[model samples]
Each structure stands twice: as C-alpha cells, then as structure tokens.
Target: MKHLLTLSISIFFITLFPSYSQDQSDNDFKEEVKRIEQLTIKSIKLRQQINPEAEQEALNDEIKTLDATLLKKVTLFLNEYGWKSKKEIGELANMGLFLAIQHSSTEEMESFKDIIERAYEADKIEENSYALYIDRLKVRNDLPQIFGTQYYFDEKSASLRFNEIEDFKNVNKRRKKVGLAKIEKYAKQNNIALD
Candidate 1:
C-alpha cells in the first residue's frame, strides 16, 4: 500500500510539472516580446514629453514612476530570460531597453554591459546604437568619449561640438567604423561651424 501511494504521488508530480520543451520556451519568449513592445511604446512617449524647464512637474513625476517600474521589470526579465533574439522582439523593444538603461544608475548600466555587448555581437542592436551607449558610459565615468554622442554648444564662441574625446586624431575613423556620420556633417546639421 505504501509503495502504491509513492507511485501515485510521483505520477502526480510529473503530470503537474512536465519538462519544458524548446517549443515552450519559444512561446514564452514570444509572449514576453509582446509585453516588452507595449511597455516600450508607452515609456518612449512619456520620455519625449519630459521637459525639466517647463512647468510640467506632474509629467516629470509620471516619468520617474514609469522609469522605476520599467527598470525593475527590464532588469528582472534580462536576468531570468536573457536577451531574446532580434527576430523575436524586434528593434522597438530593443530601443525601449536602451532608453531604460539610459535612465538607470551607473551601476545598473555597468551591470548590463555584458548583455548589451552580446546583443551587439549577435547583430541584435545596430553599431551606431552600440556606440551611443559606449559614449554615454564614458561620459558618466568622466572618461574621454569614443563615439562623440554627447555634445554641447559653446555660447560664447557659438559652436556645437562634442566633449573631450579619447583620441581626437582618429575620431572620424572610429566614428565611421561605428556608422556615425562625420563630425563636420554632424556639426553642420546642428548649425555650428567647426573651427
């Protein structure tokens, strides 16, 4: 009787929690893709409306709330499931992740570097996008930027230009390698004449 009871319990456990198959993983990933897509769209819209100088404290508060919530969700998803292939979630969701990372603390950003690097190597994210992130991290650390994304306009001299770069001489070569436009062209677009 005891042996029969043990057998029944083992069978019940197997029936309740079957082994996960590849197809099951794929389906689960697909569902996650949909969820991330929705979150990305809402977050992007909120981000665009944020203006610190304007009297929109309510909107700013909403952005902070969403950022906190989305950051937690994104971190958890990345940790548990890892990055979904580009084909699964597409560019929009990736863009949303980038924005979330941008709003995160320096420590969080550093922690996500491995995942982001893997995605870049797998061609999930574009080279230009990768360069932007690298440059942002450099700026955060007070190191010279490699890709020249962060810039400021000199009010006295009336020029728009990047901050200090690591290697000023080879900047264009590095920029070209990463799919960024030439510095002169970028300056012109921003209506600043390069000296």
Candidate 2:
C-alpha cells in the first residue's frame, strides 16, 4: 500500500513539474520553428523537382497539404505569442515564421499586416521579405505596388513579369530606400523585361 501511494505521488509530481518549464517550452518553440523552416525549404524544392511549370495536379495537392500543415502550426504559435522579434526568437526561428506566413493564404497574410509592419520597423525581418509581403498586400487591395517585388505570369509572352507599380518613374528610389537594387538591375539579373 505504501509503495502504491509513493508511486501515485511520483506520477503526480511528474505531471506537475518539469514537463513544460518556461525554458523548455521556449526551446521547443525554437526547435519547432527551425523544423518549420526546413519543411518550407523542402516544400519549395519538391515543387521545383516535381514540376516547375505547375502542370502536375499531384504536385499541387502535395504542396497544398504541406502549406496547410505549416499554416496551422504557425497560426497556433502566432495566436499564443503574437509576433516575436528576431532578437526574441533568433534569426532561424524568425525565418521559419516568415516563410510560413508567406506561404499562407492571402487573407491570412493580410491579417498579420500590423505585426509585419512592427517587425519591419524593428528590423526583425529582412528587407526583401518585407518588401515582397507589402507589395503582395498592396496589390491585393488594388493599391499600386511600391517595391515591384510581386510578380505575375504574362500570359501573352508566357513569361514572369513584375506586377505594375505606382510611380514607376521613382520605383527605383523607393526600392533603394529599402536597400533593394535598382529595378533595371534587378530585372536584368532575373531576366525580366521592362516595359
């Protein structure tokens, strides 16, 4: 009877302590973010390997499943912690969160606009990723893209082209302000044609 009582007490303590200390939970979050970043890389590579043209429905379905899994995990984390800065969570974990949000639905991405802006202002996110995210959201809302980071498929030429932007005359100035190269140089490097 004493042994049974001692075993019960031990089990109670096991459940009560050390299973999720603050440090342990933080480490778990960091590791999960790292795993998520790696998974995003694999998802992108899988698409490239399976079908760059995106004609394969099977490949599309696989990508969607992977994206959904990532989105769900990221959303849960975001709900629990809001937005974490790079200093708070480290660069690798930040990258993982960035990629997960980028791969998420447009609405889901928009929902985090304030957090993105905060992260950007705090220099917690990369300039390139920040520009891309902002450009996408702006274009979605019928506003002119400021950074020209978003691209679209030109059906007429069957080529990828930068989406239309506001004030093309000074697009480079805006991009340069954000530490991006001039649009022409960027276009040349990416093999995109300028209209």
Query: For residues 58-118, could you state the per-residue lDDT of candidate 2 as single tens digits?
Result: 7778888888887787778777776677778676667767877887777989888888888
Provide the lowest-lDDT 10-residue window in model 1.
Answer: 14-23
* Candidate 2: count of backbone clashes, pairs at least 3 residues apart or interchain: 0
TM-score of model number 1: 0.75
Error of 1 at 121 (Å): 2.7
On the 0 to 100 scale, the lDDT of residue 54 in model 2 is 53
Pairs in clash, predicted candidate 1: none
Give the TM-scores of the predictions, in the order they appear: 0.75, 0.79
Q: Encode model 1's per-residue lDDT on 1-195: one tens digit a residue.
A: 999999999998777665546568778776766777787888889878854335788887788788877787778778877775556568777776777787777888898899999988988778888898898888889899997777766666756667778887788899999998997787778665555
Those runs of model 1 whose alpha carbons end farther than 4 Å from true positions after fitting are 1-27, 50-56, 152-161, 190-195
RMSD to the hidden true structure, all candidates: 4.0, 4.4
